[model samples]
Target: MSQEKPPVPSGRRRGGLLPNARDIKAWEEGGGRGLRGFLRRTIRAYLRWNRALLLDPWIRYRPAVQLLEGQTGDLQRTLDVGSGENGLARFLGREVVGVDLDFPATVRWSNHPATLLRAIRATATALPFRDGAFDTVVSMDMIEHLPTGERPKALREMLRVARRTAIVGFPYGRRSREFDRSALAVERDRGIELGWRQEHVLRGTPGEEFHDEIIRTVGAVRPEMTLSWFGHEGMRGLRLRWRLQFLISKDSRLYGLVFFPLYRLHSRGRPKHGYRRIYVFKKAAGGKPGDRVRRPARNSVRDPD
Candidate 1:
């Protein structure tokens, strides 16, 4: 005889991992007027705050921050293309004009003291700035989101605007089925579906072919642009550790208790093929010089932080 499938939990069936339409409907139906609802909302808010402040900085952002810190040149006027919520700006510790397609209302702009400059709403393919506008341009974890054909254009625009350096970071190499399976198992065991978001538009391995494409595109404009790769290493135990930490962090803020020790252990050794890679492109010789002390327009919104 055929057996029936197990019924999914309301949270899973409705929202999968993050809060969804159905989840919002249910919460609204409950009115949040009763003591239990009030308590639930309060607890959730507290946990979210803790995750944002204590956990995300170390778990989600530390690698990129470390990479930038290691490679950054003399700090001057800077632009961060595709700077969603300005994560890199936090590590920069200075004024950086950020530009992205959209900025959600929920982001805490004031949290990062270094993001003192205004964030502009713009596109990566067509930055709304003049040529050689800034000394450094940073675009982290943003390129793979564009269509394969458009990636080259985005890179060209970044290089055109950067007078000295341009840094780009994204998931590199082939997508590992083994790693995907392990992550799925962890999320299943944790009773959550972590695949609710569809962020990576370009699929398949972003390996040799992708690197060659970038080189060809950048070469067209700045033939002498020096290209270098950082964090090119093996996966080793990094994937499993990352999965475990993500699952644990969902349960409580106490995950922070174990975060640093694990980070130190894993970070001590380099892998042969790391999941992420950073590309640094130094300006070609005889390129147009950058405009020092030039600021954004007076009408641009400026963050006082």
Candidate 2:
């Protein structure tokens, strides 16, 4: 006796991932056919997609945005060190330039939501620029990725290039390090080993000493510039939220879908304990904004600010 095929699940193909052929056929035969139906579906899908694109950045960069925008005038001349995939240009404006040693010649901006980023291949420690080359230079969540010795050099380079300000934001203190460790554990439990996470876990997050060092380094490099820092995103329930994002996997669209809204909702509070900190170093005076700061000479002389 021949056996009958099992019924397919609703809206799903039998033994496959596509929509059920029978259901699609039925819909085409009904009111779901023709130009009117196609237009309706297209508009709906576009709206949903637009919403997702609007929320494409990670929550980690929100404070960076606040700090940059906090300054007077437009962010017309800004340099982003260790810019990676985060589209800081989109938030700040097209005038923003992102430089990173990791960017391959063929590589462009990260597949971020608002992608107006302009990227260049350059090392942070030996930034190919003259002193006070930009109005503002910022490196967000990137210091921890540098080798311990290179961190000071990178910070000095940033200070040297920036005419008025240099900002460094990164996960800070023992709690921040522990938080990253716990999140890495979540990834390991699920057999997920992302390269970025591996580097972050192995390199170690900046702790109390790192914070103090940044202060002392600022004093040494640019004594006239004022240094101020504040911690953000308290630990309570942060792990659970991070665990969900890790399980979803940062490579997935589902992760992008929740990123901005989570930042918008989660960042409004005043939390005593935080997983990250932002340090803003503003020069006492000097310089004007530009559409594009001249890229330094190929063999430009480098110096401390």
Candidate 3:
């Protein structure tokens, strides 16, 4: 079967202040300015603060506890690569180490920045830890942002560092062409040229005012298939409010808040091709002949390479 292609742009419009440049500089220096910089900082802060009230209590506290009920026989050390300011360590208890290049402004743990919750600036490709130092390693929604070519080395590093298990998750699947047609129509009618253009950021020219990220209202994730499906609505012709009724209705809110634990209970340890997915790998103990291993031959831009 042919692999389904996700709708992520192949080449982001490049020019003044590329995405990687901003991220790398911010990662190393921890300082950035301008509206974009402020937006990034603000988003980081919001994610950190909402970690406890929204993410932790809902997914980390109860669902994880129940899912790992029998499997927690011997979990001493857990490491979270790219933990960011999510407060995953606090919810995972003291044994967990939350590693990230940048530390959050605030954390829930009473202990100061110590050995367990060390916040070191490090890259995924070159992790600064000993082999087999962690029992479990986990990363969520992080792999996609990495350069198209660097994922395999990073995956190998995650596998190398973890003795027991590793779990990785990210978004997948294509954007619906149906949605695009309607969306682009609106821009045409308004005399606005929408979508990405290469010349928008030519050298010596001021940056264009075109929007970078255009969100299609019809896209959604099917957790079972890990498929991000788009709708028939094109860019100009979408009935945005009416079509997104499911998301805005009280039913969705209630189901999300009240029935989330039930969803977690049913979905644990069951790997489905969702519009997003969490991939898990377990390391075999001792020199087992049947154990599977992988190494990189070259740096390339292949998915799951």
Candidate 3 residue runs with Cα over 4 Å from true position: 1-52, 56-74, 109-117, 175-271, 291-305
On lDDT, the leading prediction is 2
**Stronger candidate by TM-score (1 vs 3):** 1
lDDT of 3 by residue, 1-305 (tens): 99996553234344533343345334334437887567567545533443323432234233333333445656667777877655345555555676666776755454435434656678888888898778777776555556545655676677678766666554332332223344456545757573321121111111011000101100111111111111111222223432343353323323333344443443343222222334445544452433232223331222220
Q: Name the runs in model 2 displaced over 4 angstroms.
A: 1-57, 70-75, 104-115, 246-260, 285-305
- Model 1, runs deviating above 4 Å: 1-74, 106-117, 175-197, 232-234, 264-270, 284-305
Better of 1 and 3 by lDDT: 1
lDDT of 2 by residue, 114-192 (tens): 5566687789898888898888888877888888878878888898898887777777767777777877887789897
CA error at residue 227 for candidate 1, angstroms: 0.8
Q: In TM-score terms, which candidate is top?
A: 2
lDDT of each: 0.62, 0.66, 0.45
On the 0 to 100 scale, the lDDT of residue 257 in model 1 is 46
**Candidate 3: clashing residue pairs, number:** 19
Please give the range of 10 consecutive residues that has the lowest summed lDDT in model 2. Answer: 287-296
Of the candidates numbered 1 and 2, which has the greater lDDT value? 2
| lDDT of candidate 1 over 117-217, digit per residue (tens) | 56788989999988889878888767767777777888889989987777787667654324545566766686866542133422433566777777677
- Ordered from best to worst lDDT, the candidate numbers read 2, 1, 3
